[model samples]
Target: MAHLELTGLCKAYGAICIADRMSLSVPEAQVLGIIGPNGAGKSSLFNMISGDVQPDAGTISISGRDTTGLPSRRLAKLGVGRTYQIPRPFGGMTVFENLLVAARFAGGLGASDARKKCGEVLEATELSHLTDETAGGLRLLDRKRLELSRALVTDPELLLLDEIAGGLTDAECISLVAFIGELNKAGITILWIEHVLHALIEVAHRVIAVNAGQILADGSAEDVMASKDVREIYLGSAEALA
Candidate 1:
């Protein structure tokens, strides 16, 4: 069965339809990459699936169960985890504390289980040495890592990452890409919306481009980016892909 599936999904803001009878299915452990220009409704589509936005029509299913309109927290308990385009860690809390909260509330773990989960996550994310540091004090990379680490606390089967590599240095983006690949190798199904083309192409098994709330192209990363329609959607197409 598909890990996540959307059938005839529809959403809109007044006359601007964001999803027009869209149907897609994501199989387990597949790293699907989404590429599109800003305002192409990529994030909106994610919001609807993650339950931050309700669709005007259609069904969303996870593991063969109808989950349309389920709230974000409820989805969290069902093994759906996502990270925002921006890191929103609790500034005053320590790294461990932030993760502990996610493990307890998001993962629904007991006290001991929560602590253990936090410890394991911190180490896995390579933030163990900074476990006691205040989140606000972290530099950009560590803060981003914390955001990713918190999402993992829920032990997500389907992970939604929205521009997780945005605003990072080239070297940092490379590192993050490798880490994401490792997560996928360990069995997490990833649906990533990313603008960082080079980094995305390195790891995604398949890529699709969305334009005006519809799929413009779908194929291997290079093939999709090479499509004439996709190029036209991106300003200075060749440069955009580069």
Candidate 2:
């Protein structure tokens, strides 16, 4: 059975539709990449799956159990974890404190267990050096790492990442790509929505392109980028095709 599945998902705001009858599935340990233009419903799709917003119509299942419209906290317990396009770490809290909250609330761990998990996550995300730093004072890269660390504290089976590589320098993006590759190797299933095509292509086993709330292409990363429709959509942005 698929690790994560979305069937006939539909959402709209007034007359503007987002996620119009969309369906997708990701197998266990597989990395699926999602790409689209701005406002093409990429983030909205993540929102629905993570239960930040309810779809008007759809069935979402994780590990074959139906989980449509479940609240975020409940979904977190069910092994769903995600990072937003914009990192939202608690400003005044220390990095360790921020991760501890996720472990306690999202992972439902006891104090000791939460501390253990937070430490492990910090090590995994390479943020141990910043443990005592205030989250709000972190640099962009550290903040992004904290976002990833927080989600991982939940020990999710299905991890959703939204543009985790955005705004990084090329070298930093390369480092992040390697880090994400390591995460996938560690057995976390990933569903990534990113405009950084090269980074996504490097880590994803397959890729899908969304346009106007619908899938325009789905296949191997190379093939999807080479698709006539995808090329047309990214016409002038040659980097997206590269």
Top TM-score model: 2
lDDT of 1: 0.89
Provide the lDDT at 55 for model 2.
94
Runs off by more than 4 Å, candidate 2: 236-242
lDDT of 2 by residue, 2-33 (tens): 99889999999999998899999889999999
Residues 1-242, candidate 1, lDDT per residue (tens digit)? 99989998888898998888888888899999999888888988888888889899999999999999899989888888888777788999999999988899879999999999889888888899999999999987788888889999989888999888878898888888999999999999999999888889999999989888888888899899779898878866666766
lDDT scores of the candidates, listed in order: 0.89, 0.91
Poorly placed runs, candidate 1 (over 4 Å): 236-242
Q: What overall lDDT, based on C-alpha atoms, would model 2 receive against the true structure?
A: 0.91
Question: How many clashes in each structure?
Answer: 0, 0
Candidate 1: pairs in clash: none
